[model samples]
Target: MVSIKKGSLYIVATPIGHLQDLSPRAQSILREVDFIAAEDTRHSRHLLNHFGITTPLQSLHEHNERFKSPVLLQRLHDGESMALISDAGTPLISDPGGFLIQAAHAMQLNIIAIPGPSALISALSVAGFSADRFVFEGFLPAKSGARQQRLKKLLEESRTLVFYEAPHRIFDCLNDLVQIFGEKREAVLVKELTKVFETVYRDTLSGLFDWLNARAERQKGEFVIVVQGAQFDNKAIDPKTERIFWLLRQELSLKKAAKLASEITGVSKNTLYQFALDSKNV
Candidate 1:
């Protein structure tokens, strides 16, 4: 039972990649609002201009969001309804303005959402991975060691894993993922989604890394990585691991077989070694 104020703050969504995806409701709201708070004035200018939306615009991004929150809150308090939009997609999602929204809520001011496109949702739509359960990891650590450690943490995750990466960091990031998650893990790489030169590639982790490395041009756009969920089984070990252990046992000692299996499967070598010893005892 939320009351609608005559001059409410409207949180609108713009297009993530395609300008045409901008909803008519979003366009109308942009045109009708007393003012609009945008993440990037220049980027939003192009969008507003394309639709002939001439509403007064104000900047509200990471650099100035803190100082501007109070001012925007004051405007809303004064019964001046405005619309908040990001350079692309919805606001407060890897964008700024979380504090301002909370402030508005506290004041009991009318708040509304004009939904449209989101990059995360857009990428997931074409990823072709299991969507029943997924985790949206906005961005990875910029450093090498930290990033690899994070990927290692998700090695056993049973749900699909999604991540956003900048163009400059894509190659190195993918390299680290292959090292941590194993070369055979399946992954889908979606780039510049919905925009020209958009590409969706589904392949093994090593293959995607090789493809990106071979083509310098392929590394220029924003990227989304969707990794297949881990398969779970219990019969002492997975079929894949059991087969590897069996093959290695034929040529190597029990300790060496476990080490080889652990390296190949990214499992614990000690655990595999104990299993191998138990099998020998049997």
Candidate 2:
């Protein structure tokens, strides 16, 4: 009795934690789809079973996405409705299924988006950071050096920064953040969002490190780290200096931008650096 359109591929968003977060529409489409393509058949099986959905499941993870797309597309061409679901959260946001979606477009097939829960958006909603303009740099590198190098690029980012970190490397990642972003940088760590042990811990980078180190239990869940962006002030300053500094910042890091702007404008380096941390830069 489900009204799912034949031959449409539904990019369904599953619940990140609480099972009830799944939309009624998502459940209906999933229940009636010809077959569901899932990131993990085993994990998606539990969710489907809970809702009493007996739809068949096919595995479509990062490893076999390329090879699997053609087969899935053929099913679509045969007028079969297909629903794609991840183990959790929306499919293709730091998860797989992007390739299949892309291939569907190339075939001129109807692709539907079924909105649902997302850990990234959920974390941002409660993190108390400015969400107007922020970046979602999914997960940092597992290795310390590569991760630190990656963090270095965002040192001057004026917009709020968000990242996902595994519990195993959370400590090392926080240590690198303290080392590069400075111990005093303001940040929030959200763990086990929307679940039983959901906790939101906001503190200076150094404080977070100590708190996590203090208790082994603190570092036991999935995490979303939201760091306050570079601060800026809305004070009157030389227009020429602002122009130069703003232009330089577009091409370089905060340190290099302030340094070069100071040189060009004959303004003190410290003064320009101060500009880098106010309402304007933020």
Candidate 3:
């Protein structure tokens, strides 16, 4: 029982990479709508030109969404049906459209979704990770310290974790993942999905880091990182003891690794540092 009305707000998902992925319903809605509020007018124009859709487009991106959304909402109030589209993929998904959608919802405007392609979903579909329960972390913080803090918290996450990273930062992001999730953590890096030269590389965090490092120039385009959930090691490797063991194993003679691991795992660096000393002596 779908009731689509005039003067509505249609949240349409555009193709993430390939234009053919745009659904027929999405195309119809975009063509039939009075105007389209797009994250990028120029990019939307390309899609519109491809489909021969000449609907008017207005910019409603991060730079001006708060100011522009009210105007779009007013147009909706004035009996103009508007469709919201991102540069690619779903709107309000790590994109600028949440505020506009919120205002529309608050005003009780008729809103409909013309679903199509989502980079996150597409990546997850091919990630070979648990899709049953996962969290879309959008994009990681650009700052290393903040990113590491967040990753530290997520290290204990029981559900699959998904994150988007840019080309230039993908390698650093993978390196940070190795540091926080440990070298042996399994992960999938999906790049250029649905486009020419699409790649899905899966391996341990350390191996992935090494692979990416070897091909530093190949780290380009949007990246989706799918990390497997934490597993319960029932072998009685308590968090504290595990931290000590990993530190002792990796550091060998260097006391810094043990001290850092203890600080990160909150297992008392002094104690672990002492253990490192004892193990070295043995």
Candidate 4:
């Protein structure tokens, strides 16, 4: 029998899609915990039913987590162990229950993490990009303007970029990526990961966009977009060129400054613009 200590909070990772992906330890913890706190009781019940695990569940989503954290913490203090789970994948990764975990730490309560399936890690493993270093942006802003601004901020990121997108906004997100990152930038779109209809499309930004449009069903699943970082030789800009570029940027807009600096120094305008963006000198 798996021994679950009392007065401890177990952070369990549920399967993102496939039910079998839930580890034996996670199942044991879930079955043995006093009760489970889930983002959605109904959704989690289904998973529990499949495994024949009859452990009771309580709701702890974004809207009510603030109010419920104390209540759950008190239960822990009363010697009741609990497991926290999101609707899918790991809890608190683009999901709720962060406040509860933080409170647990502050209260000096025991917290254990049972790691399992994560969409971010699953997508990155097969992305074939630089896995050594990467950034997980989670979900971007819903509105186009805010989303574009966020992408613009990461325009010069050299490490791989990972993001999650809903089915409805996948098209617009990919469009903005193409516009900001350029058509030829390499990217991978992993959809409905670990499920029967899983699809992994790898190509340039424009090519991925076209590939999605070519098949309507391709756009109808949870999406994980992995983008290759900007390829630029920062050392290519000599001190003389950088000095002139900074001086021009102060006097004119980024476009005009990059153009004038490029013409004067014989450096690429794109490189100058990227430099300005990275240094925030523009």
Candidate 5:
């Protein structure tokens, strides 16, 4: 029999898509806990029914987490063990239930994590990119302007970048990526992961955009996009050239400034353009 410690909060990771991905230990903990705190009780009920786990569930989503956390903490203080689960994957990874966990820590309550599948990790595993160093940007801003602005900041990041994107915005996201990061930047798009129609496409940003546009059916699932990081140049920008560019930028349009600076400093136009982009981000 699985042991449940009194007054403990178990942070369990559920499967993202494939039901079989749920670990045996996670199943044991879920069945043994007094009650489960789920992001959506109705959605979670299906998962529970599959495993014949009848543990009671309480909703603890973003809207009501603040109000619900106190009550949950009191129950834990009174020695009721609970498990926190999201609709999919791990709780609090671009999901809700963070407040309850934070409250548990502040009170010095017993807390444990039951590791399992994560879409981020799964996508990275098959992304065919350098995973030695990477950044998990849970999701990008919904609006184009804000999303592009955020992408601009990440343009110079040397580490691989991972992001979760919705089906509807996948096309738009790719378009922006091609425009900002350039058409030839290597990237991978994994959709409907671990599902019957799972698809993985590895191509340049522009090529992926064109491929997705070929079939409407391809746009219909949760997407994990892995993008290769910018290749950093070994040669540093000359101090005088950068100073001249900034001084010109103050008085002229960025394009005009970069153009004139390139000519005056005998620097490549592409290098000066990139320098201007980095400066604006700063």
Candidate 6:
């Protein structure tokens, strides 16, 4: 029996996919709270009913969060405990609840966390990239131009990058990524995590793009993309390798040229790729 804290605003994390992934503490918190602020009441009602919890639910999504924050805060001030939950996974992670959480902070109420499943953390765990430092860019812009521009700015970032993507735009997103990030850049696509049809694919940008377009079924699921950040080694490249890079660039894209040149010279592709860019500017 978990003790429900009075006047506390619990930020509970629910299951991302698997029902059993919801922690016992999270279930207890939801059931014990005076009410739950859900991203979607209809969707959340089903989840609560599944767990045999009949906690009252009120809608609190991006559209109405700002307006409803004050009302919910007042309830908390009245010594009523509340739990904030998203449609799935952790609250405020590419989801709503920021306004309510912020209002609670202003009132100096208890803000508790009941952590559980998270798609971002789950994807990183199996991405095989350097997870020590990472950046989570929840969802890319819907437009092609904006998405490309956003990716371009992060081209030089040395930490792993994570993104959540919609199923319908997954292919288009990959196309833009390949264009800006280079086909030789390594990336991982995690789909339907914790679900029965879950898949984790690791490949170069081009390879993953090809594989995704090769089959229509692969494109139908929630996606989390983990991309390796720019990497460069300190070993100075000899003139021969530099010459090889130029030779390849004559017929290949900068990234492709760097990949081939590095293969021949045993130099770092990112280092050679950066050199290609610098040389092009000069």
Highest-scoring model, lDDT: 4
Expressed as tens digits, the lDDT of each residue in 109-225 for candidate 6 is 999999999999999999999898899999999999999999998887667999999999999999999999899999999999999999999999999999999999999999999
lDDT of 1 by residue, 1-282 (tens): 123345699999998788999887778788877899998899899989999989899999888988998888888888887999998777887789898888888888889998888878877788888787788888999999999889888876667899989999999999999999899999999998779999999999999999999999999998989988765443558889988888888888887887788899977765665465446641
Clashes of each: 0, 6, 0, 0, 0, 0
Identify the candidate with maximal TM-score: 2
Candidate-wise lDDT, in order: 0.85, 0.89, 0.83, 0.93, 0.89, 0.90
Residue 121, candidate 1: C-alpha displacement in angstroms: 0.9
Task: Give the per-residue lDDT digits (tens) of candidate 5, residues 137-186.
Answer: 98899999999999998886767999999999998998899888999999
User: Which digits, one per residue and each the tens of the lDDT, describe model 3 over residues 200-277?
Assistant: 999999988888888766687888999998764333336667656564666464457655666666665445544544
**Which residue window of length 10 is worst by lDDT in model 5?**
273-282
C-alpha lDDT of residue 172 in model 1: 95
**10 residues in a row with least lDDT, candidate 6:** 273-282
Score candidate 4 by lDDT: 0.93
**Poorest stretch of ten by lDDT in candidate 2:** 273-282
TM-score of 3: 0.82
Q: Which candidate, 4 or 6, would have the higher lDDT against the true structure?
A: 4
Error (Å) of candidate 2 at residue 233 is: 5.0
Shift in Å, residue 39, candidate 3? 0.5
How close is every model to the real structure, measured as TM-score?
0.80, 0.87, 0.82, 0.85, 0.84, 0.84
Instruction: For candidate 2, write residues 1-282 as lDDT tens digits.
Output: 468888999999999899999999999999999999999999999999999999999999999999999999999989999999998999998999888988999999999999989989998998898999899999999999999999888886777899999999999999999999999999999999889999999999899999999999999998999999866453535887888888888889888987888788777655677666654652
lDDT of 4 by residue, 118-203 (tens): 99999999999989889999999999999999999888777799999999999999999988888999999999999999988899
Q: Where in model 5 is the C-alpha error above 4 Å? A: 235-282
What RMSD, rounded to one decimal, does every model reach? Answer: 9.2, 4.2, 9.7, 5.9, 6.7, 8.7
